[model samples]
Target: MKAKNGSMVAYDGEMAFKKLSGGGEGIRGMVTRRITGEQMTVMEVKGHGTCWFADRASEINLVGLQGDKLYVESSNFLAADAGLRTGTSFTGARGASQGNGLFTTTVEGHGQVAIMSDGPAVVLRVSAQYPLTVDPGAYVAHQGNLRQSFQSGVTFRTLLGEGGGEAFQIRFEGDGLVYVQPSERNTIAGDV
Candidate 1:
């Protein structure tokens, strides 16, 4: 499995950790990530049995993917099966609103991934009839065939400091599940 560097807490069996420079994406991926500013450091863990991984005691959620892609922020990603492919992709305005820059991490293929959040994560289903809108700071990860668009409620009132607390959000349509943390992060749009 590939896990975030320095996230391993313990293991009951024999294990080896090898630092995967450039997020295990090789030279080309390294260059791409560096240029996009979505850099992530990963380590390959092998011969593991009951391996434990954690980040600052954050809550962890396990997601299973069956040949589908998972979109997650680099900060929330914990680990994934080695068979899965991991990379970076552009996130447009949603990323900017969260203060996470313009790119986010992606995991694909048939495998399980572990994601971390500040608090327990709520899995919200988004169907054709029931779309879901999420605060950028509260978003953790999403899976399935989902289309995400940035939504803003800012108006003239916002300029006068009377805006709703949630002025920026990411709306998900199509069909998928979105993971949202109970707590929101400190973001550029936190007060908007």
Candidate 2:
């Protein structure tokens, strides 16, 4: 398994951890998903029976992919099965806010991916008829066939401090599961 460096808390049985590589790409090519060049620390855990990984006591959730792709923020990605392919994809638009990311980590293949959130994350179902709109800060990840689009409700009032916190929303339609953390990520727009 490929996991974040320093994320190993405890493990039972024989295990070996090696610094996979440097320069952003992890052992399985897992990227931090930052085009601005932030180093991603990753390590390969081999011969492990039960390995525990955690980051700041955050809640961990497992997402299963069967020949599908999971789009997740680099901050939420914890670890993934060895066979899963990890990479980065360009997120089309910026939310008129500074904190929403422009690139997201992409995991493909048939395996389970562990994601972490500051709190528990809820899985919402998006169907052809029932679309879902999510605050970008609260979004964790999404999987399956889905169309993602951004809706910015920025107005002059927003600039003058009379607008709601939900000035930006990410709409998702089609068939898929969307992960939303109970708490919002720290974003510049949150103050607005």
Give the number of the best model, judged by TM-score. Answer: 1
The TM-score measured for candidate 1 stands at: 0.98
lDDT for each residue of candidate 2 in 52-162, tens digit (9 for 90 to 100):
999999999999999999987767889988888777766666333426456666789998999998789999999999999988888888998999898888899899989
Candidate 1: regions farther than 4 A off: none
Total clashing pairs for each candidate: 0, 0
Clashing residue pairs in candidate 1 are: none
- The lDDT for every candidate, in the order shown, is 0.94, 0.80
RMSD for each model, in Å, please?
Answer: 0.8, 2.7
Estimate the overall C-alpha local distance difference test score of candidate 2. 0.80
Q: Give the number of the best model, judged by lDDT.
A: 1
Worst ten-residue run, lDDT, model 1? 46-55
TM-score of each candidate structure, all chains considered together: 0.98, 0.89
